[model samples]
Each structure stands twice: as C-alpha cells, then as structure tokens.
Target: MNSQDETQIAVLRNLYAKQAHLIDTGQHEGWAQTFTADGEFHSPTYGEPAIGHDQLADISRRFSESAQQAGERHRHVIENIWVTECDGSSAQVRAYVMIVGTDIERKQARILRIVTNIDQLEKSADGWLIRHRKVEY
Candidate 1:
C-alpha cells in the first residue's frame, strides 16, 4: 500500500475508535456527528433504519436513555476492521462489533451481541464521515 493508503487507513481506524468511545460514554450527539448529514444507519434491533443526522441522534439518545434507565452500561468492542476499498475521497469498511452489556447494580457484564458493520464512508470538509452503515448479526 502507498503512503496515502496508509494514512487513510489510519484515519479510518481512528474514526472507529472514536465512534466506540463516543457511544460508550453516552455522547449521543458527538456519535451522530461521525456520520454525514444525510447518513443512514440500519440495525435489526432498532426497528427501522435511522436516516439523516437528526434521526441518528434521536436513536442514539433513545438508546442512551434506555440504558441509563435500566442502570446498564454498554461497551462496544470494534475489531477486525478492514478497509475493503478506498479511493482519494471514499472507502468501504467492514468491522466486527461485540457489544458488552453491564448491569450496574449487579456489577456484571456479558456479551450482548456480536455483529458485522459494513460502512460506506466519504471524505467531506469535516474529514471522513459515514454515508451509510448496515449492521448484520
């Protein structure tokens, strides 16, 4: 791979890590900003795909609230990330996600789900943003 590819890959890796941190910390708005303005997220567990940043933020907020209400914690382990394709301005990425859920009261944590995330990313003025993300369990 060329240096440019290496740099892009690094940036993509950082993006994934940042995304996980945002979600884990319940930074819903910050997490939503990782997406493009018109980005879409498809999750089987979420009932329907969330389209656009507003919808995405709403979903994030709902999830955060639900977890908080239940006294639960979520940690998303993103691993095995592969940049399947990359151009100067866009890339296709796939990664495995393992969500660990913790019960604050019981101080117990367990793997809640495992899935593969396929993301379509684009380079915008703000840097790389997710154009679409489809989650497969």
Candidate 2:
C-alpha cells in the first residue's frame, strides 16, 4: 500500500473508533456530529430503510431515555472491519458489531443484537464524514 492509502485507512479508522466510543458512552450529541448533516443511520441489515440524521438524533434521545429508565448499561463491540477502495478521500467499509447489554436489576447479560454495516465515507473541508451508510441486521 502507498502512503496515500495508509493515510485514508488511518483516517477512517480514527473516525470510526470515535463513533464507537460515543455510542458506548451514550453521547448522542457527539455521535450525531460524526456524520454529515444529511447522513443516514440504519440497522445492520443489508437493505434496510434509513432515517435521516435528525431522525437518528431523535431515536438516540429515546434510546437514552429508555436506558436511563431501565438503569441499563451497554457495551457495543465493533470488530472485523474490512476496508475496500481506499482513495485518501473516500472508501467503502464493512464491519460487524455486537451490542451487549447488562441489566443491573436482573443481573443478566443479554446479547441485544448483531449488526453489519456497509458504509461510504467522504472527506470534505470539515473532516471525514459518512456520506452514505447502509446497515443490516
């Protein structure tokens, strides 16, 4: 791989790592900022309909509220990410994510879901942004 290729992969990895941290910490506001204004967030499905960034924000809000109400703690693990077509400014990516939730009251660990995402990323004047994201369960 060339230097340019290395740079692009590094950028994408950094951005994605930040997103994972934000989600794990329940920082919905910061997580929403990681995408472009018109970015879409979907499930891990290969062809699921997506809600826009604004809608995603709303969903995050509701999720946070519910988590607080239930006193739940969660850790989202993103693994086995493979990057293709790296071009310094954009690329296509695939990743597998597992969300584990723990209920303090019940003392039980549950595997909430498994997710896969195919994402298109672009780097603009501002920074690396997710141009299009398709998620499948």
Candidate 3:
C-alpha cells in the first residue's frame, strides 16, 4: 500500500530466500539465526517441535547429515508468500514451500514434499525474526 509497506514485504520475501539458501547449503547455525532465540518450529515431518536455538540448530544439523549420507541435495523453494497481518512490531505470514531433492549420482531431481507454512514473526532491532512456524503437509 504505502512505500514502507512495500519495503517490509520485500524484506520479508528476502528473509525467506535467505533462509532457504542457508538451510540448503548446510549452514545450520545461520539458518537457526533466522528465528528468535525462543522460536519454535512445529511440523509433522519432524515428529516433535523444535524449540529454542539449540534444538533448531540440532535439527538443521541432523537434516543436513541425512541428506549428505543419502548422497542427495535438497532445495527449499518458498513461494506465494503473503503477509496476512502486520503491525509495526509483529506480523503473520503464510507461504508454500516445496522441497526438491536431487540425487547426485543419478543426476535426477524430484519433489520431496510440498508444505504450507504459517509463521508468526516479530520485528526486533536486528530485523524480522520468526517467532513460531507451523508446517502442514
């Protein structure tokens, strides 16, 4: 609507792109930093929700290891990002995330999973951080 609003949306979009790259490249710590210290991630695929920085980073590490052992590379494509609600300090966003996996030896890529992510975000001095994310497959 306004210039400020447009800027915020663009920043949020960039956040998603940054997160995807971090996780895909096995930058576990950096990916976890996209969230707040007490952030939570809930997903059926993970069985248990990962809370706090330590748990978040651990999950990323495990994910990276699994993919590496399988001789596969994964990519996260975040699309249709919508800032459903936004106040100055907080926002609710939704997006579709498609996880694509590539088998290095086979040179084949396939869609691993498609999930919808609903996220609660907070604006801090450092910028926007995800407070909580719920993923539905």
Q: Best-fitting candidate, measured by TM-score?
A: 3
Ranking by TM-score: 3, 1, 2
Count of backbone collisions in candidate 2? 8
What TM-score, computed on C-alpha atoms, does each candidate reach? 0.95, 0.82, 0.97
What are the lDDT scores of the predictions, listed in order?
0.92, 0.74, 0.93
Question: What is the C-alpha lDDT profile of model 3 across 44-134, one tens digit per residue?
Answer: 9888999998999987888788788879998899999999988878999999999888999999999889999999999999999999999
Model 3, position 100, has a per-residue lDDT of: 89
Clashes of each: 0, 8, 0
Ranking by lDDT: 3, 1, 2
Per-residue lDDT of 1-137 in model 1, one digit per residue for the tens? 99989999999999999999997887888999999999999999797999988899887887777778878998889999999999979999999999888999999998889999999999999999999999999
Model 2, 5-94: lDDT tens per residue?
777777787888888788667788777777777878765431344455766566556556666676787766788778877776777898
